[model samples]
Target: MRDLEAGLVDAATGHAIVATDADGVVVVFSRGAEILLGYPCDEVLGSHVARLFDEAELGSVLAAGDLDTDAPARREWTLRGRDGVPVPAEVVVTRRPGVGGVPAGHLFVATDLTERRQAEQLQDELIGKLGHDLRSPLTSVLGYAQLLDDDTLTDEQRGYVNAIERNGRRLLHLINELQTGTGRSRSAWRGRRIRRR
Candidate 1:
């Protein structure tokens, strides 16, 4: 039996805890486990952890040599919940050290990353907006500089103009990449719509 008070304290810290046998049968499933995996103890206990996995991504996940074997294993895997929704989860599995410092049953902890996806989307939007706002001035500066010729300008003026053109062109390159995420020459630009959003 689990110590409910201690388990609750652990749950408050955000790690979902479980214990399983070597063959993968779940033994102890805590509330944190319930929230993270989205299957209650009654349903998950005595069940294989593999049941929580998406069958398709499993082979590659195992082949990656990514399992932690240090009395406990730690890994990240995209797991499917009872609702059949795929979620990114961080997992840690450790064996309880026994008399000879050998493992008893496996102990597992999982953390769900629902908030992380939101943060990444917000970051991408900010970068895309910053890139879009800087594009117009850079285009104008490059346009004016390209119109100048060496015969009409002093050496220092030519050098300054060249620097301006180079920086503007670089800025344009970065903005295009941010907007479309692909490199396309001006000839290709006419037919393709940039994926700015």
Candidate 2:
């Protein structure tokens, strides 16, 4: 008797994994896939993945191609979970290439964005609140500096006001850019050339 290594990889590292054949039949379904999609590997392994994504056009851009050129189409699409709940998830398809650089099959690697999306929404709210909070102090500082810069004030006071204005401008720039999307690698985002840190 031959022993086949069965039943999932590390759940921590292996959350939601699905495999498909040339005909797009789910061949290897892991425990992680079950937890994420609510479908057992045994029940889903032979089924078409499109059934989960077809209603929402999840397989529209999908085709058998090399990973470098095709494979992962990083886009926001709705996926149908086992309970018929529509999940907003990001689908990443990794393609396998065989010998002679030909396309073989596809391996899908999915990271659930449900929680991440919620976090992003919360972050947006915090940023807005922080920006508004900072604006109040900034406005006060600007007003005080402007009053000092008036002809009624001395030369040294005018210089200090100018410095304050410059620092205020710098703070505004800091809030807008570096703190934003620079935190994540733009693997799915297009156009902008990434500068390596």
**4-120: candidate 1 lDDT, tens digit per residue:** 755574555476777777676877777777777678779998888778777766677568644435645667767787898987877776765556765556676778877877786
lDDT of 2 by residue, 1-197 (tens): 11233433424344567767766788777676678778866778788878766463653464433234643656566767899887667767776566787756667766677898888778777766777778778878877767777786677877777888777765655455433645443333334543322
What is the alpha-carbon lDDT of model 1 when measured against the actual structure? 0.71
Work out the TM-score per prediction: 0.70, 0.68
Superposed Cα deviation of residue 93, candidate 1 (Å): 2.7
Error of 1 at 11 (Å): 3.4
On a 0 to 100 scale, what is the lDDT of residue 42 in model 1? 97
Runs in model 1 deviating more than 4 A are 1-5, 8-10, 59-68, 71-73, 98-102, 129-133, 173-197
> Per-prediction RMSD in angstroms?
8.1, 6.8
Say which candidate scores most in lDDT: 1
lDDT score, residue 41, model 1? 76
